[model samples]
Structure formats: C-alpha cells, structure tokens
Target: MEIKFEQKIPVLLEKAGKKGMTYKELSIKCKAKKEEGKYFRLAVQKCKAAGLILEKKGKFFATQSKGLYPAVIKRLHKTYGFAERLEQKDEVFILGSKLKGALAGDKVMIRLSKHTRGNLPEGEVISFIEAGEVEFTGIAHLTKGGPFITPDDIGNFDLRLEGSVKGVADGDKVTAKITKRGQGHRDLRAKVVKSFGQATRAAACCEAILNLNGVTPEFPPQVLEEAKFLAQRGIKHKELLNREDLRNEVIFTIDGADSKDLDDAISLSKYQDFYILGVHIADVSYYVREKTALDEEALRRGTSIYYANKVVPMLPKELSNGICSLNPDEERLAFSAIMTLSKDGKLLDYDFKKSVICSRVKGVYSEVNEIIAGTAGKEILAKYRDVLHVIPLMKELSDILHHNRKLRGAPDIDTAESKLILDENDRIVDIVPRQRGEAEEMIEEFMLTANEAAATLAKKLQIPFVYRVHEYPDGEKLNVLKETLQALGLPAREIKGNVPSKVLSDILDEAKGKPFYPIVSRQVLRSMAKAKYSETPIGHYGLALENYAHFTSPIRRYPDLTIHRILSDVVTQKRSASDIKKRYSEFVGRSANASTEAEISAMKVERDCEDCYKAEYMEDHVGESFDGMITSVTSFGFYVGLPNTVEGLVRIEALPEGQYQYDGLMELKETHTGNAFRVGDAIRVTCSGVDVNAGNIDFVPAEPESDENG
Candidate 1:
C-alpha cells in the first residue's frame, strides 16, 4: 500500500533525524515529477503547519527535536491564557503575544520557554491541532465595523462579525459562528446566527447560557417516540418473571412536594435489634435499554440540571415523570436493596434483587419532618396515616446512622444553597436559603446505605462498575486552610501535614455556632476535593465511605442508570463475574468519563443560570440595606452573603478611599485605618448596582456603620 503524500511527509521527516534535510533534497529523494512537485510542496507545508515537521533555515525536521508539547487551552483571560499539557500535570502560561490567537478549550502544540511565572511554565503556541468551539454566545454591540460580540467566557475581547447582522441589534444576546480563523484576536470574524432578546433581561441571558452549555429541556423526536412507547407499554405481567414482588410492602417515596421525577422509595421495619431497610429505586435501565434512543440521550445528558423552578431532565418526562417514576400506588419495576443493619446503623448483610413495588403514598419531606417533630396539622397527619407507623422507625435509624457518620469522622460541611422563589411570570420574588431538614437527611442516609451495598456487591463479585469516588484534598490547599484558620485566630493545630476528616470535623465542631462558622465550613469545603464518578473505587473522603456508588435516582442521573444496567445483568440475568467483566470492563471507563464531564457541565449551567435569576431579583431591591456576612475576600472585593443567601460584591472602590491589602486567602485590610475585613465579618451593605446580563451585583457600605468585625 502506498502512503498518502500528507501522511508520508511527517514519517519521512521524522526518519531524517536531527541533522534534517532541505525541501529540495526531500523532493529529489521522492523522485517527484514536475507536476507532482507542487503536491509534494503542499504536503510539506501542511506538515509544517500541523507542527508535525519544523523548518529551520530551510532545513526540515520533526517537531519532536524541538520538544513541542501538545496542550489544551484551559482558560483565556484578557491579556493571557493557560494551556494544560495533555496527560500531564503541568500547565503553561501564554502571554497575549504568545497565544497566537488560540482560544480556551482549543488543542494546540506549544514550545516551552525558559521563563516562568512563579511555578507555572511559560510557553508559546506553535500550531493548532483542533478548534474547540466554533460558536459562542455573547452580548452583541454595534461597533463602527458592524456588530461585535463580547463572549461570556472569554473576557475583554470582542469578536468582529462578518458582513451585516440584520436582526441582532445592540445589546441583543446572540450566538455567532466563527467564519474566519485568524492569527490574532483582531483578525477573527464571526456571523450572528441566532439571537435571544435584550441582554438586560435575565431570561434572555439564561437562554444563551443554556444554549452554550448544550442543555435543553426538549428531547429529540426519536427519543420522545421511544419514551412514549415505553410509557404506554407500562409494566407487563410477563416482564415480572423471576422478580421479587414487594407490592404489598409499605414502601413510599420522599421528595420535595413539587418534584416530578420521583425515583427512589423506601420502607423500614424493625425486627428486635435489626432494621430491615428496603430501598427501592426505579428500574430505569429496564425501560431505557442499552443502545436505544432514550438511553443514548440520557448518557449524553448524564444528569438532570435543576435551576430555579425549571429542570432539564436526563430522560424525557414520559419516563422520568410517567411510567418509570415511583409514583404513589403505582406498581413500578424497581431494583431493591434490602439491608439488614444493626440498630446502631452497621450494615450486617444486604440482598440486591430485581423487584416490583407499589409505593403506598407520596411522602413529602416537610410533612415527614413535621410528623417527627409532632408539628403535623390534621391534613398532613391524615395524608401520611398509611405510612405513619414507619416514620418513627426511620427517624430512629437516621439518628443511629448520623451518629455512625460522626463516629467515623465524616466532616459535616454545609454550604448555603439558595432557593429562588419565582412569581407566576417567572420572575424571582424572593431568594431564600434552602434548609435541609431531618427528613432530607434521613432519606440521604438511606440512599447512602444502598449505594454502599451496591458498590460492595460489585467489589465482592469482582465485576466492572462505576464507583462514586472522592480522593483526599491536595496538600497545598490544606496549608492554605491552616494559614487562614491561624489568621482568623481559630485553632490550626490539627490542620498540619496529612489532615484527616476527623481533624476537619473537630475544627468545624469547635467553630460551630460561632459568628464565623459559615466561613469555616466554606473553607473546609474549599479544602476538599470534588467527588466524581470513577471506575476505580478510591473511596469518598467527604462521606468517609470505603465503598460507594450512585444507586438511586436513575431517572435523573446517568451514573445511577449505569449502575442499574450493570447490576441488572448480575441480579436479573444472573450473569457470571467473568462474563460481566468481559462485557462491561471497557464500557465502565467510558461511562465514568462521560458521566463526570456531563455532571460538571450541568453544574456550571445551573450555577450560571441561577446567578442570573438572583441578579434579576436583586434588580428590584436596589438601595435597600441588609446585614450580611463576608463569605470570601478577593483582591478586588469581598463577597457578602445575606441570611437569605443573596450574595453581592463590596468592591474595593466602594470602601473608604485607602490602600487595601489582601491577605491572599480571606482577609482584606485597609492600610491607613488598620480596619480589617475578613471572611465571616458581618457588615451592613446597600445594593448599589446590578448588571443582570453579567449576573453581577454590586454593594456599598451603609451609612456610618460600615465594617463590623466578627
């Protein structure tokens, strides 16, 4: 077989060694005719442009000789960018001049420079390998050279539009496709393809954000058809063959009152010292079979994104909220994990089975908490009368499990999560901190037990499966935590060296009920690594669990669905360990990676979209003074979070005219007045300004009472 000229040029150049060869000499070696000479020259040029071959003083050599590394542009700032080396730990900092028009997420080859900015190595882009995003969503402005777009992600740079943009007026949020690639930001050209309404509206900004993240509430026609068919089919009698029937059991689901995708349900029974806890998860894998349209779409989505009042589900509502949902009194297919645990919450033994269950009632968390608190109204009591006997047992088991978690030294780090209360017109009327009550914690503990059991079974069987893993925190972040604690005059003794979960737990315990408890909790959370899905069971640090997997919420989470798919073969099909491993070994790794990426994307979308909603709400509250605590301090400003979970930045300019020095972690001190504003400090601030499109809220000190130290 003859090699294509483009492919052959790189191989031939590489084989020529460090001595290199001239273009004319290479052409002669190929014995190219006059007509074929032009094609050979083109191949050489392509190879050189691709960073496969380098030309120095008319001599050609492979790029390896010059030590060019392939990297992905991780982030781009106004004047600089950082490229993370592929499959490597190091990141290269590229100045604006060295970037060579590379954008964030682009793959490129770079030549390392001798210079270094602190510990980061400096590099220059040599050649492009692949373009990351050809389209971007941003606010368009009418410039002298037609309309230009200022992208949401890329800062301070305007992308010039090619030709005239008809419908995209000034301040309209639009998505533009790159029409011409360039060697610099100034040369890049794009055309507006679509536009949301005015950028000033939070709704318009949110739509663009959702589009940019590839999140949609709409399902494809094929996936919808598949879901519709499965919903209509419902549960067939023949499909229940060889499955355990627990339809008569007093099992029920507990979720938010407005939640539609009810997936996991539970039942509890006390037998002397052991509690037979039944966790029945909606068997989504049965309906969303492998390689089907519904399954593919779910895998692509990975997890449902919930922002404000809306949700972008992983699966269609036909499955998520219809037949596959564990609705009250509905006989639904389920994967049941019946665990026999000691009264002290120790897992004695567990059984995983393909089962059918009829949830007796839809249990609301608030109502369950009221029952436990003896605060339930007559209506609430009557609603839960059927499963009222099991509520106390759940509370008892939850207390035992909570004690077990505390004993195992799992840090109880809590962050303030906001719930945007939207009006009928979808405008935010209030932003309140979402509180997790005892009922929520009980459900969480129950889910954790089932997840651990699932992972334990996979490990016991030695089968390939996805595990929810959270590795230990980085040593550098721990050091920062130690310094911050010491600076705050808190105990830093246990934060040294290899810190355990118990030490952090102790720190939080000491800080509990203190004015700075929120900041301490936030700092501890910041010091921990993010929990993600993995094929390898490395353990979860936050939960202090050795074995864990997402075995619940298969209706919304792809990782849970993946777990169900693998376990179905083991429990339902009764497949051998060897067979299961052979079938899913490679598939688990791919699923884990895809699930993690999708989860990250969903989280970003949720956070960004929620910020816009919050900003929109704050727009109506400008000029109002509110007492808030400093959650974090940056060089430019300190972020103040109100009790309602509304956070705004107190910019450095808003402070008294003085030089302010940032301690680099959480404190900002006015050099002149010796007044220090640190994380956890309380202050009264007035909402000064808000940029709804950018989701930025600005605050200023209120009156004479500005800074209040904790």
Candidate 2:
C-alpha cells in the first residue's frame, strides 16, 4: 500500500510522539523503498512545516501541541506576512504564501510554517476564524463560465460561484455568504446572498460597510418585538417598593442636541463643606433579562456604531430611545452611584442603588458650553436656570478631579476629532473639527468618578469582575519616544526603568504650542498599548487608577451591561454565593475576551467608515492646494495631515526628483538637494485623486495658490 506524502507525515508524527527519532532511524522505521527516501524526507519536512513535529539536537519528536492560535494579520511584506497585536505573543511572523488568504484585521488560526537555524519560528495561517463571521459586499460579474464576486477592496481575488447568477447583473453590487474555499486563490468562491443597487451611491456605500464588517444595521424581528412589548409594559409599582426614590433630586442629562439614546443622567446636592454627586445610569438590565432575544442581540453587537448620517444601535431603538432613555421630567429606572466628595475632589464615600429618578431638564453640550463661556443668550440661560447655578460647581469639581488625575500621572491628550457633516441625500456637506469644551469635560469627569466608584466596590467585594486596563508602555516604545523628541529638538529625557506616565506627560507638555504638537501627541499615543477588558485588575495606566470599570453607557457598550448584571446579582442577592460566583467567574472570563474582540472590531469599522467619509469629501477637491503637516513616513511615501485631520499620502516618486533615503529618525532625505522631510514638517500639498474603494487620498507637493490669483 502506498500513501501520499501528506498522508505519510501524520503517521510518522504520531509514531514519533512515543519516542524521539533520528533521521536515519526514522528512515528505517518508515520502511520506505530506496526510491521513496526523498518522498519520505519530504513528508518529514511537511510535518515540521505544519509544526506537528520538532527537531532538537538532530532528534525528531511529536510536538503534542495544538499550535493553533488566533493572530491578527497586520501587514503583508515581500515573501513574508506579519501577525501583530496577538494575544498570545508580541507578534507572529508568517511566510507569505502560507497566509492562506488573510488580510489586515482578519483573525486567523496559525501554526509554525518553518523553523530555520538561528531564526525565530515563522507561522502560516491554517484557517481563517471569524471575528464574528465573514461576509463581503462587492460588485459581481456574470461570466460565460460562472458568476464571480469581487470585494470592493481588501481581497483582490474574485469569488467564483458554484451555480447560476441571480438578480445581480454583471456590474451590480451584492453581498454574499462565504460558503466554501478553493484549494488555491483562483478557486475561492461565495454564494450571492443579497444585492444592493449601484456602486458609489449612498445606500451602496453604507450597505457595503455594514456587510463587510458583519454588522446588522437593523434589529431582528423577534428582538424588535420584544423591545416593543417592553416599551408598552410600564415599570411595575411593586418593583419600585425597595428602590431608592430620587424623583425629587435635581437631576438632568446632558448630550448632543440631536442625541436621543440617553442612558445616563447627573444630579448634585449641597452637603456641609462637601457635595453629593449622583450619576444615574439607565437600568437596561431590568428590561433586558438574561437569555432573552434582546439580551442576546445586545451581547452579539457588543457596541453601537455611529456614522456620518446613521447609527447601528446595539439595542432596539424602542428601548434605547424610549423607556430606557433618561429623558427630561420623566421618572426612569436607573442604577445610581451616589458619591460624597470634598471640595478638593476626594471621594469620601459612595453608595450604589437601584433608583427611580425624575430628571428636571435635558441640557445640550453646546448651550451649556455657552453658559460656561459667559456668552449664553438671555433666553437660553433662562431655559437652563434650574441647573445654571450648579454648572459652576460642576466645573469646580471637574478642575479638582482633572488636577488630581494629572498629579497621579494620567495625561490629558486632548486632540480634536473630525466630524463629517452630511446632507439629507447623504452627500458630504462639510467636514468640521469637533473639540470638547467645559461642559463635555465636566460630564466626563463625573462619569469617570461614577465608574471609579463602581470599580472600587467590585474590588472591595473581591468578586469576579472585568476591569478596563491600559498597561504601561514597554521600554522599546519609550526609546522610540525619546528618539522622536530628539528629532523634534526637544529634550530626549532618559527613562530610568518602568517610567511613570507623568514622565511622558511632561514630554508632551514640552511639545505644546508647537506646530507639530498633534503629530507628537499621536505618535506617543501609537506607542502606548491598547486599553482592553480584563477579568483581573491590573490598574488603568491611562487613567492612573488602581481600579476602574465601565459602569456607564450600558445601552451602547456590552461591557457596561455586563458590569450592571454583575452589580445587580451581587447587590440584590446581598452576597456572592457559590453558584453566583461560579456563574460570574465564567462570565468574567468569556465576556472579557469576547467584548475586547468586539470592541476592537467595532473600532476598525468606525475607522473604515471615517476613511470612507473623508475620501467622499475630498473627491471634489482635486487640484486644490492646502497647508498640511507630514504625519507619517513609509518606504512608499509620507502622509500629510490637513488642519481638519484628513490625511493624504505624498508618494516618494512625487517628491522633487532625487534618491531619498530614510534617515535614522525616519525622515526621508533627498541625496541631491539634501532636502529632508520628517514627521512634523509643515508642507503645502495639492489635492490628488481619492481612491474611495481603497480608502486612500493621494497628494502631490506644491505651493498653495494665492487668493488674489484665484
């Protein structure tokens, strides 16, 4: 009987597990004929490549290790692929061909591709695991042989269909289910699941984003039915018997003018030389009980995704915008955090309870900002007279909290984000920069206090819980920061050991008022580790807190919802029993993992949409020149950021003709003219083509045209 090389390796590897084998001994054990020695040797190599067997000191042994690990495909370099931001290790290196059709942000199971002498083990993707699940929206073509779908971006390979074409024509855009994979790139295919209208249209772009990210833009029928039923079912009178009645408290919610899915409200009271601050978060858990369709849907979503003109709400709007919302003058269910704090913002004590709160007013951030600025119109000031007196007190507390946070080494990296305004037709009307004002900051401070209070309580109880953690930056990154500072002619401060966040914060303060402050701030941010959900308390480095949990925004973030459920169980039950502890122990682990994954995925979706919106806005501005700063440098080119935060690349070839090389500081220097362009350098650039499908905006260097000439 003859076995193929692929088949022969598994048998040899299984046998090798019992005892280590030398190549000569393995050849003898294989019982292969002289002609099959090369084939047998090839089989051994295959086994090694798949990481099923390992050779140490010239003896082969079965690894007995399921080397499968989920890795993020960050970038594809020549002949090699890189897996970065992995939970298992710092990074996993992969052979390019062994990628098995993976792209950036794709989650995949990988094993060792090969282990060579004096080199780190490289990996190969064995399977593409679903982040949630894979579905691509793209344009499809009907060929004579069969119909195939091509993703709008990302995957360049056409997905061949097994059957006949559907309603989608040759040039039509469609969404599909990835039913099967071909052995090679050419054979990969999917079934046409749904069809959209045309490409580049408003609906088509939105549909493509939702499908590609595996985000359902609407709630399921059953989930909607549940929400509608609950909306009609008012809170039972008996349910309020034991709850704290805060209906008389001077409580109100502050949000954007157009906001409706309000989930948190704030109240304040005077208490002899101190202040009583109350943060009332919507009691979403009361309505969304465990195992229900509503609860399942919310967990699956993980978080809401907001776009230029749309929002994919985590919960059905009937609840998020209805009964669960803390609208003004309405009595609503809430999980309240009542804190007593001194004038200097020291939390003396806090109490948590299920409460019924009647909010006095619904305030807008813009109007409240006006009040703080002393520019509020008489009518606007009068409208908010009930809460106007407390606004100044809120600011006083906010300043104290902010000062204490800074003293504890938490830096406030305040950077403005872009807000793409869309017209009714979904076309980009304008792109504006949105900056947080006093009103927003005060609310943020109060919410942070509430979150901190809840986290402290959870830790005190010593129960299983998930904490939001931002770990300290590694030494190598601080070294890079040191280099960046040196390049900027700022002090290259040496970090002795595990440096405090204040050290970095001080460096950022030095960069203040500089033209490249944004670049420096952003680069430092990139050097820091991502904040994630963890079952264990490692402290939040960014917040400089020993304990922290997300107790706010339960209507949107699943982590907050999970926290609420835990608090409900622990507080209501009056003790963490064995059953409850075991249940939450499992929940803490599973939810942390799933929720972190979901949060990252949702962030990617948001970034992708932001890029799309930027491209849409820039499409009409071709040939227009604007002043921008060089924000990034790569071998291909450098990216320039406009004032509004839109970044476009200036390719190396487009630079003033010369051979440019990357300096030690990552600046591209021209050999002939000796002109050097590094990050933070201000340059003028003309608008270039916008590749919407690829989410790229290209720019060429030029001097801005004078207004008189125009």
Candidate 3:
C-alpha cells in the first residue's frame, strides 16, 4: 500500500512530538521504498510551501512556533518592500534579498528580526501560500539574452521575457503576463501577451492602460444578446400597471454637450411656503433583472468610466443610451422622488413611486448657463423654449440649498479637473481646465435632495440597502494636517479625536480668494476619508448629511441600480419586511463590496489614462516657460501646477546647488543659504522633458531664480 503523504505528514509530525523528526526518521516511519523516498521528499516540500509545517534545525514541526506572523506583501521597491500584517495594522519591512520570491499582494508567512528601519519593523518572508496576479504594461526592447519589458509603473529593472518575441518588436507598447515568479525584480520572468502599436503614441499607451486595469470595452456575446433582446421588447402596458403616468410634466435633463447616457431629469413647482421638487431617474432595473447576464455584467463593472473623448460604459449602449436613457419627447419608465421642501431648503416630506415621464428638452450646462446670464444666442433660446419657465425656479432652489449647505458646514473643495482635446487622428492637441457652471450646481442639488430622500425611506422601513458612506478622517492624518497648517503660518486647531466637518469648512472659508486657497484645499481633501458604498448607513462626512443614498444615475451607477431594485419591492408590496431582509441581506453586502472595488478600479484607470494624454500634449511644448504654483512638496521633489491644470515634477537635484532637507511637512529647506521651497509659492518653470509612455513630465526653474523665502 502506498502512503498518502499529504494526509500522513501532519499526523506523523504531530506524533513525533515537539522534538520533531528528521527527514530520515519520517521516511522510516512511512515505510517507504527507494523510489518512494523521492515522493516523500516532494510531499515534505509541498507541506512546507503550504505552511502546514515549519522546519528548524533539520527537524520538521507541524505547528508554527512563536514570532511567526502571516502577512500580505503590499509593495515592492528596488531594494526593499513592505508587507502588512494580516492580524493588525502594522507593517513589516523586508529587504529585496529576504523577499523569498514574494511579490506584491502575495500572502506569506514571515518571521520578525531584531532590526528596524526608522519606525517600521523588519522581517523576512519564510514561505508564500499564494501568488498575486499582476499584469505589467510597458515598452518592449530586444536584448542580447532575449526581449525584456521596461515597465511603466516601475523603473528599477526590466522584466525578462521567457519566450520568442514573434510579433512584438522593439519600441512597441505591450502587456506581459508573469510566467515565473522570482526573489526580486532582476529574476522575474514574463511572456508578452499583447502588443499595442508604438510606445510614442498616446493612443496606444491608453489602450495598454485599459488592458492593464481590466477595463474591457467589449462585452460578452451573451450579455449583448440579452441586452438587445430586452431593448427590442420596449415598454409593455402590463409592466406599467401600477406606475404613475406623468408624461405631461415639464421634465428635462442637464448634462455635458456630448453626454448620451441620460439618467436623471428634474421638474419643480412652487407652492406658497414649500416647493415640490420632482427628480425622476431612469428605471434601469425594469430591464436588468436580478441574476440575468446583463445585470451580472453591470454588477461586475459597477460604474461607467469617461476619459478624454472615450467612455467604458457599465451597460451596453443598447440600454444605456437607448431604452433606459431619458431622451427628449420619449416616454420612458422612471423612479420618481417627489420631495416637498420648505422655503429655506429643508426637507419637509417625500414620496417615491414608479412613473413614466417624457423629457421636454435635452439641456446643456453651458447653454443653460448662458441663458441664465442673458447672453445666450437666439438659437440656444429657441432650443429650450419648451422648458424656459422652470429655469429661474431651478436657480432659486439651488441657491437656497447652497446657503443651507454652507450653514451646515459642508466643505466645498474644487480640485480643478482637466479636459483633454484630441485632434482628428486621436492625438492630444491641448489641455485645459474643465469648466463648471451654475446649471451643474442646480442639478447636483436636486440629485442630493433625491438621494437623501431615498436613504430616509430605507431607514424608516429598516430595510437592507446599499448606502454611499463617507466616514470621519483618521486621527493620524488629521494630526499631520494640523502640523502642516502651523508650518505654513495658518491657524491650527486642537483636535482630540475626529473633528467635525464644520471646522475644516471654516478653515477653507478663511482661505477662500487667497493665493494659498489651492494649497489649503488640497490639504483638507487629503485629510478626509474616501467615500465608498456600504450595507450600513454611515452618514457622509463631507456632505454633512445624516441620510444619503445614490438614487440617481441608475444607468451609470450600480449602487443606484441596486437602490431601485430594493425600492421596487417596497413600493409594489411584493414582499414583507422579514421576507425582504431574508432575501437581500447577503445580496446587499456583496453588492456594496463589489461596487466599491469596481469604483476604485475605474478611478485609477481614468486618472492614469488622463495622465498619458496630458503628457502627449505637453510633448509638443517642451522648453516653453510658464508661471505656475507649487501645489505639493515631497521628500524627493515638488509638483508645480499650471493654469491649464497640467502638473509636472521638479526634482530636488534639478534645483540650484545646495544641501536641501525636507521639513517633513510642506517645506524643503537648504542648510547653508536658508532658502526654502514651500507650497503655494509662485515660480516660473520651463518644460524640460516628457515621457509619454510613463506619463511623466519634468520641469526645471527657468533662468536665474531664488527660493520662495528669498
């Protein structure tokens, strides 16, 4: 009979006691033949790799000894890496040589050593239980040994290609998959799986970015077929049995000039003491039912992503831009929130219902802003003739709401988003700041009112649902902000734990209209926690709202779709409270987690893609000088932002000759000259170099210059 080493090894080791047993003793206990010796040795290696046993002093033990901890590798640098403990928030620093073939995101067992780098604990990886899946996007180059890829994310070393480069040549942008993991960057091997034209072209680099982030433009055939079939079905009378017919209401959508996935519309009516604000969102759940292929795909994607002139929509255009879109003069299914607000913008009462609406016009933000300013052209006025009466009322309600938000201390931070202009050949020509108008604010206020109503309804009924939550900032981050403020000669408050939103709002209010407003706003934003979807209704800190849910834009947001689905059951009285909870408890948790992860992924993709386009545009203007402000300072360098929203790095080495040291807050100072570079300092910079493939722009001070303090 053959010994099952997998089952027998653990028991045998445990039976051998704490003293453990040597390899020869274990083989003897198993009664293995000469040929089986090799098999036994292989099984022991497998056991060790799986963390089932630990070997010390030539003896194997089934249980782990003291000081051994489980950790996940968080990041890998050229000479070192950091791994976070699985049981706590602490991190361990491991030198590249001690990584033991571990990669980022790998789960491994580590043993702490009597060493420390700064404040971090030092450790060495013992064994890896799992490998992380990471794809590398880079420019492929031919070397004497073979072909290698210089990754865009990491510049420490190149990844060696294991096989022949058949279709890929030098200077081509490519994506590679890991074929073999190694101890460090120098030994890792990968295989080229895709090639995207030349590396010099921003379009090709953008394509590689999409693949690297797993944002597929094309959908599965089954999902597309289902979407097409459902779209063709159209709106049937039987499906509108309990829905309210509001097709005559003067509802309209306001969006960008080129937006096609129209999701939300607004209508307002004035009363003596209160206003009836009707926010009707597209009923996407009517077509995308639970567990269907279309629903699965939307859930996987979570949200739509827009970059430059391109979009990776969560739903197929057949539904997003066709059936579920709220187009002008088209009767479409909608979920309406009829909110009654006081004259002072306080919510008095609300009702939600299934309805049908016909949009009066497709409103453009710029055109509406022009109309409000009385500068619109005759053609623009003629386009909005049907819904002209409601424009003033929209503005009135938005102003009142804005005042209310200010009173309640909601910090208004403008990050100044960038817009990229592309030529006929898909090459970027210019970069500029994206403009926002009053029409955008009006629409935003309406959406917030509707979202708050939805969450209040869910809380009143105590139902399981997904919520958009933003918690308070961490204490450590807040402390860092206080130190930075004091360093810049700004007011610093004494915060015990978590400070309220009003405190940060006051700081911003004081800094408004000043040259340092940008720097102050950036610091406040960095101190705030990120908003995410959750099954629990944690109030949003930034919005200063106790109740909030994403009830608008169902066509583009998965959380909004989920809210619509749950409200369907409540409004139709299809299920009792207990039944609803039993059916959706687990579902809500899963959707919230999946949606949060997908949203983060989509954000990264958009930011990275925008950087490549910006670099491409900057490539044409090299050596041109521009006046810019220092937006941020780091240990290695500082970043400068131009009026067009383009940012570039000015490394410490590029500055005037001096021994400079970082103040660890917001200033980089030189020891001998007493010169310093601080945030919000005005300086002249000349574009020195551009790396389109890596999305990097380098800048240096133009001609003779002195530090900000001088």
- In the range 120-158, model 3's lDDT, one tens digit per residue, is 999999777778886678889987877888876533678
**lDDT (tens digit, per residue) of candidate 1 on 1-710:** 11367777666767887888898878776666788877887787777555577778989887776688667888877688899987475889999888888888788889998999857999999878788876777888997866788876554578777776787789998888777878787778888878998987777888888887788879999999998998888888997886899989999999998999999999999999999999999999889898998888888999999988988889888888999899998889999999999977899999999999999989888888899999999999898889999999999999999999998889998888998888887778888889799999999999999999999999888789999999888888898888878877986575656567888888889889999989888888988988899999988888888999999889888989998999999886668778888889998998999999998988888888888998999999899999999989999989999999888999999998899999888889999899999888889999999988878899998887546783
- lDDT by residue (tens digit), candidate 2, 461-563: 8888888988988777777777887888887687645778888788778888999789789867876889999999889888889999999999998889998
Ranking of models by TM-score: 1, 3, 2
Q: Which model scores highest in TM-score?
A: 1
Candidate 3 overall lDDT versus native = 0.88
* Residue 159, candidate 1: C-alpha displacement in angstroms: 3.4
Leading candidate by lDDT: 3
Please state the error at residue 251 of candidate 2 in Å: 0.4
Candidate 2 clash pair list? none
What is the TM-score of each predicted model, taking all chains together?
A: 0.92, 0.85, 0.91
Rate residue 69 of model 1 by lDDT: 69
Q: Give per-candidate clash totals.
A: 0, 0, 0
Instruction: Kindly give the stretch of ten consecutive residues in candidate 1 with the minimal lDDT sum.
Output: 1-10
